[model samples]
Target chain A: MAEKSSELKLLSAWFSPMALRAKIALNIKGLEYENVEEDFNSKSHLLLRSNPVHKKVPVLIHGEKSICESSIIVQYIDEVWSNNNAPSILPQHAYDSAIARFWVSYIDEKLFVCAKNIQDAGKSDEEKKPHSEQLEEEMLVRLEEAFNKCSDKKPFFGGNNIGLIDIALGSFLPVLGLIEEINGRMVLVEDKFPGLINWAVNFAANPAVAGTFPEIDKLILFGKTLLKKMGYCL
Target chain B: MAEKSSELKLLSAWFSPMALRAKIALNIKGLEYENVEEDFNSKSHLLLRSNPVHKKVPVLIHGEKSICESSIIVQYIDEVWSNNNAPSILPQHAYDSAIARFWVSYIDEKLFVCAKNIQDAGKSDEEKKPHSEQLEEEMLVRLEEAFNKCSDKKPFFGGNNIGLIDIALGSFLPVLGLIEEINGRMVLVEDKFPGLINWAVNFAANPAVAGTFPEIDKLILFGKTLLKKMGYCL
Candidate 1:
């Protein structure tokens, strides 16, 4: 029963969590959209034209308007089509919304860097010794605090439904799991980050999140391939 | 005309452009707030408790609510006191607001680094060579594009009044000016960045900007002192 709504197109990459954020948000809202996977080596004209600043992926085109950056795009999508029956991504209260946005920014600013470093280090044996371990310890402590902050009452960052913060952080779960699997180590284990672990499980098990998240095996394979590319493989 | 409304207090530092952003935003909004200048060496408990995550100022304390991150605090200030007579710092339109926020983020993520490099270089002879020159070129091109993007038909980033992008970028003006003064060269000349230069002049000349910005001579002194502290100068 679609009647000429604004066309939504997402320029995404399979393994990129940033693109996964856009993907999950769209699916959660029950919005019908076309997904065009961008080649990592050669970006499309649309991607470039849409996001000339960063020229990166996860560009959401709603008719003529193209919103770049995953968090920004997610907010835009939520605002533009806000009449959805799905749970509100951003909190209703201004302060809560601010807090949500802050966490989302924090994930990008802090946690993402640590995660990337761990991923890179996992690929490299020499650097993986004590450096990655130290970062992992720091990451765990921070994530523990963050989990306590976000999961004050409920399973998710916003308490009830999968909110903005949830979407932002959850997108990286598959890759993180893959990293743990490859390294034969536990990252966000239940003991240290109980709330985060529970939230991750709930997020992964959701119907909306079903097909959106890439397979763990596929991600591990990609990670291993990257390691090989970097000339550091078993 | 100060009513017993919500108590506003800004946890700030003079040398920090980020803190300066919160100051400018509060001033532009005509919001009466207490400014608690933080000593970089010994950070106050209020700043720590208020902003537990970053533990950095400017933390805007309105009542018991503590907002951290300068840009986020600026946005919060705009939203909270939105009914004020002051022109809206953020644009009304969704897309425009996104673009405004994007440019502000750009200023932080991109321009701020180049600026820091130039500022440091200005303080030392060793860094005055090709290193700072290369950074200056990059900064000019990126900033030129940023200016063009933000300014459509008006002077300020949000067009008419000083907007989010303006506050974010303009916070560095005093520091930038001091850098130019120390180097004996103009950083943002009219010819290279006419629109930006014009905007900067208008921004500095504005009454709201006055008193909030640290004096140029004092800033230069601070820069030189910092250089000395870093052992770059005798």
Candidate 2:
């Protein structure tokens, strides 16, 4: 099918997991879009006008319309590009779709909150390591169960394809890598969360997202800068 | 289309606006469900098991499947009951549906946060009256614009039918009423937010959610009790 004439533009920021979700979705759907990177400190007028409510990055502009919030943007991409030959990001079945949405919410609300807590703990990596790992372990165990339930032994949450949950969680791979590096240990233990560990590896290796992540070094630098900005020493 | 043989069960609490959303959606779709009211102090095992993550109410059980989260449950109800001869809760078009979802999110995250802050302010009604009114007024102006954009002069966000955004914001009418009553005078001033004031009236009067609200006196009592429990003087 020929791509629609209306050009798609993404107002995004580097090192943003939310923006990465939109990038991966467009890649998976085989859609072409202009990725206009936005500076976090001095945001462009387009970003402000496009997402006036949140005024956040990762606003997907399609022709005259702009969709904000990463998960919503991903869904918009999937729905608007339904005629494309690429696999749909959301599950086709209603029940499965609900389950996918449920876990995606979990990742955004629960999982990422834990990540932020760890990063903002303000203690030396050694001081916060045990508590941080424990906090994440609880969430990881639940996510492992979720991975088993949602993936059903398949390689991806969408069974054979990269789906919403995959994109939502996988977008955090680089940031999680930065956290792991800063903490000097792995939070995603292979023994405790085998399914998720495998899923993470597969997700990063997926063609749709293989090249989507920022370099780990860049992520680490960005994390430090952010934490410093937030008045956290570490 | 025949109704599914499996019965629908909703684990909900009487005083919860979140639970009210599920009720309104089921009502709009003309779906009959057994609403098992849960005690706030001692939640049911079914609710805990169905929604272990949040351990909250408004879990919709259909045969073996249980859907947690109010918005997810509403969407599930819409999809599962697609064959029913009732108006759809979500819009038909993709972009319109996304906009509806965005506003629903705004109501939940932004509008409701303002409501909770007013209720938990701990000041005497007279002391907090102006501040509470101002806090709610700011959100109301944005909601007024959203109403105009989404409803486009129609009676409801769903264009004369009760839709997702309507259920999302409408469920809080009684609570808003409670907040208004406690503050002495109205938060939703008729002059400032004519559309929303009229909408609040129409939404409460709708057959779907007409009799769903708890009595205002009972709501005030509940509000005071909750505030006291949270160590707020008011």
| Residues B1-234 of candidate 1: C-alpha lDDT, one tens digit per residue | 332435888888777788888888888878788889987678899988998777887898888888888888887877777886887888887788777777777778766765566556344666655545754676666766777877885777768788988898898787677768867988787777887788888888887787777777887887778754753321
Clashes of 1: 0
Write down the lDDT that model 1 would get: 0.76
Model 1: which residue pairs collide?
Answer: none
Candidate 2, backbone clash total: 0
Off by over 4 Å in 1: A1-6, A121-126, A129-136, A227-234, B1-6, B120-135, B227-234
Model 2 ranges with Cα > 4 A deviation: A2-6, A121-134, A230-234, B1-6, B121-134, B230-234
lDDT of 2 by residue, B78-100 (tens): 98888788889988888888888
> Which candidate has the top score in TM-score?
2
Mind giving the per-residue lDDT tens digits that candidate 2 earns over A1-234? 535535889999877889999999989988878889987668899999999988988899988898988888898889988877889888887788888899988888777776776777466767666657655767778878888988889998788899998999898788678778867888788887789889988998888898889988877886877756855322
Best by DockQ: 2
Which window of ten consecutive residues has the lowest lDDT sum in model 1 chain B?
B225-234
